[model samples]
Target: MRRDPKSTTVRRTPWPEGAERALGTPLQPSVVYTAADPDALDRIYDDGAPGFTYAREAHPNAEVLAAKIDRLEGAEGGIVLGSGMAAATAVMMGLLKAGDHVIGADQLYGRSLRMLAEDLPRLGIATTLADACDASAIEAAIRSETRLILIEIVSNPTLRVADLERIAALCRERDILLAVDNTFTTPRAIRPFEHGADLVIHSVTKLLAGHSDATLGYVAARDPELRERLRVTAITLGLTASPFDCWLAERGLFTFELRYDRAEENAAALAAHLAGLEGVQVLYPGRSDHPQHDRAAALLGTRFGNMVTFQIEGERDAANALVRAAGQIGFAPTLGDVSTTLSHPATSSHRALTPEARAALGITEGTFRVSVGVEPVETLCAEFEAAIRAAQA
Candidate 1:
């Protein structure tokens, strides 16, 4: 067994100062590794002495970013994956087995809902969907077979905050592992483990990476045993993050605080502005009107996250028109980028689920998600106002 770089007894060389600056460097995507050099090969994988066995198994780029994330997340270890779904699936599959049950939030990432509703069942894993906002609902959903409880710190599409501390405590009492997706409230805003969550997951593709350039995910666990299991599952399933994508993710992390700082301010200001406007139904974690506003305030404080969603007063066509009208906004599924990106969940991110399923989660056709960027609040407000007016017209 190889020693982790961070292990105190490892006696490893110290990382250079400004090592953090390396994260944002553009990735050299075409770097090739060859096994022909015997000396290099020996150094790379001597008796599993520590370090890369293959690019798939490990990469300096990925490890570097993972290290930073682990620090930010306050976790024993973290594993990066190809996507958020990969991260979720790896954690669940690695930790839970056949006949084991999972209690997951009803308002999870659409792909996650599908994974639980459609895929996990086929594998003989049972799941019960509960409203994460209600700790009692989660408690009720947990069966004797339940081994994992999954919740999102801030749900996707709908910017709702979960009662993670209470729920995590409940899971701990019941001896079940708790996993919270911290995608919306990136580690910079709040570290979920501090609130008792056993494992924290991130769609690095979203806020952690803080750019539209990379597709990556991560799982940070409090316990070393669980973290190792996640890593093993990732290695076996080939759910590893690409070195280049990891590099890009790292780059995104460097400016994460700055980006989110701007985006958060923008989101709050925009949310307030939207709430005051007539006929727009806004959903923002920052607002006191949010369903779990008090809880969000208690946990995340001033940073309620960058995601802001609202519904146009009109129907689906009108909403689609509004999306099209926002010409500066990228009409894509990605989030947490420097450039404001918009997504229509029913058609993009949640397209995998059925209409009924989406409706169940309050994800309507008119629901528009905005990953607030560093754009001036006034500019973004203007774009939104113009789009809404166009949709109404």
Candidate 2:
């Protein structure tokens, strides 16, 4: 009493004539390798295969995705890591020794700030967090021990766009490496290397993954030496991403343009809408009135990112209520998901920092961060309007 085969779900496709078919199984893609003599294996042992003899060093999935990222970022090479912090850590560890110093933006992702300001110091590496937007501040911060100058394409929380070209020139004059966290402005909107960055990094968990399904990171460099150092360090540290995660991140890459287009649209609209509302302090880089709007527009052009940070009139209680009231929205710290997410930096992403550190970065209690999704702009606006009204009430 077997069920009819026609009743089962099946996808039928026509195969070309003489297409290799025995049991109708698809053939797996093959890789070509050469090991003609015993000397080949010995040479491999001696060379260590460029520091990638283990999957933890370089998985096939990660290589494929890294190649794609290299192309997208316009770099000579790329390496994918388990997380954003891992990527950053690899860069710092590979390029800087105990006596080295790093100059980073005053306003950076909380974890990044911690890594540079607190963690690196423990290892005898010092850091200076200066206003990255000001070329003079960055120039003044450079010291003989300063090996790297790190800046974000767009500042998180503050959403200020840095002048990469100017900074790049400065770093070049001083013979220092310029590493940029291009997480906020993905390559889709801005290519950091073109603007003079020595290395570019991404938290692929965000817009690059678009769906927020994978936690992956990537680092790329145009300079061959820097690329090799980063890759070797990654291999030694064993912080590479898994094949499945790389595959997920690769699939997400296909629709990067489409997802970002829609989300950017929503972000622009929502930014404008929130500006007109009462009892709210909206900070959107896309808006003309924003402090760094011109810089953002110049760097990102017409397509700004899908992140918005605003402060409510009340306190953390009011902010929490607004977040809770927006039950329709995903209330989580993670961003770049297909579904919108809301979070409070003070308590979530930046919570590891002390109160003084958080305040220094302006992660106030009343601040609410939003990652706009592909939901209809009207629906999103309505939800936010209702949430803000609830907060004010």
Candidate 3:
């Protein structure tokens, strides 16, 4: 449509529909869009029609991103949220009421534990912590009021692997929802639904986005109705994902498998080198010496993922010295970056946990988690060898 120059200060132009299609996904930042007629507008708003009305409720970039993730994870429906915690909040808020109870893996990410232990209680929801790798322990913790069971496929920092299929079966028998955090083991490894998980969650800020540049989270489910419940909660709570972030994440998604393959290889090589180093204990799911190595092998097959955690022979001073000396790797608390990075649990991820609690979880001041990146394996090992020697000295 054309407007008179005297009557309008701006003109809008669109690509000719039949002429050509761009090879790239266009970045859509518009928060509000128009419809052809009142009925069409109503359909967009009320019927969940095939058009975006607002970025907060629905947007092109997020829709495409969500759909792609749903397919990758074998989900009937999916939604993108503001951050990893936002997706976690959506699951808790959307599924439970005041009297309900939730069971979480004792080794969940510190922020997730904080939400379950502290934040959810404020809403009159109660939570129980269980040894996620032990199916019987989780079953014993379940109560009549239990509404959900949350566990990470590969527990953070310590690399414990939960028996997802076993836990999912228990959730089914008890008529409870099973939500598995697949952040560490991305969908390239396993689809939770095939193991009977009701919901699959991800810190898309991690491997899915493949780059540290994008910060977003995702929730997907085999049940579309359950997904709607989550979507509604995200909308009401203003937890919807940012359109620009979604675009960046989608762009990142295109090369995710490629990036992950290289990163995974580097992680394995780095873990081997770390294992050979003196005065360090390496924790990786792929290592047979790990506590849950058998379970990890059965659950994840060969795609054991890219995170590596190690403990220094000494304490806080040793960890600090290594961080200071590890010039080749960035000292970033967060993970899933393209370049290798290191984080101290006592000071960063698990800092919220009491010193005693941290010690109990095996997260001492000497423990460091590495987010292995798609870099040359030799370069990473050499840097780590120097860092360890300097710290020991």
lDDT of 2 by residue, 1-393 (tens): 999987766844334688566652233222223354667656765765532334665656787788888888887678999988889988999999999999999888889988987899999999999988898999999999889998997787767778777889999999999999998878888888888888899999998887877899999887889888998899888887867778888888888889988998999899889888987888888887888788877777887889988878877778877887799999887788877888888888788878887777777788888998899999999999999998888
Q: lDDT of candidate 3?
A: 0.89
Top of the candidates by TM-score? 3
Full ranking by TM-score: 3, 1, 2
Can you list the residue pairs that collide in candidate 2? Answer: none
TM-score of each: 0.89, 0.88, 0.96
Q: Write the per-residue lDDT of candidate 3 for residues 1-393, one digit (tens) a residue.
A: 886786764656554586678788888888788778899988877886788777788888888899889888988669999999899989999989998999999998999999999999999999999999899999999999999999999988888899788899999999999999999898899999899999889999988997788889999867878988998999999998888899899898899898888989999999999999888899999998889898889988999889999988887788778988997688988888778889887888889999999888888888889999988999999999899998999
Q: How many residue pairs collide in each prediction? A: 1, 0, 0
Could you tell me the TM-score of candidate 1? 0.89
What lDDT does candidate 2 reach at residue 207? 85
Stretches off by above 4 angstroms in model 1 are 1-48
The superposed Cα distance between candidate 1 and the true structure at residue 122, in angstroms, equals 0.4
* Structure candidate 3, residue pairs in collision: none
Q: How much lDDT does each candidate structure score?
A: 0.83, 0.84, 0.89
Instruction: Please list the Cα RMSD from the true structure of every candidate, rounded to 1 decimal place.
Output: 7.7, 6.9, 2.1
The residue-by-residue lDDT of candidate 1 on 125-178, one tens digit each, is: 998899988888888887888999888888888978888888988988999999
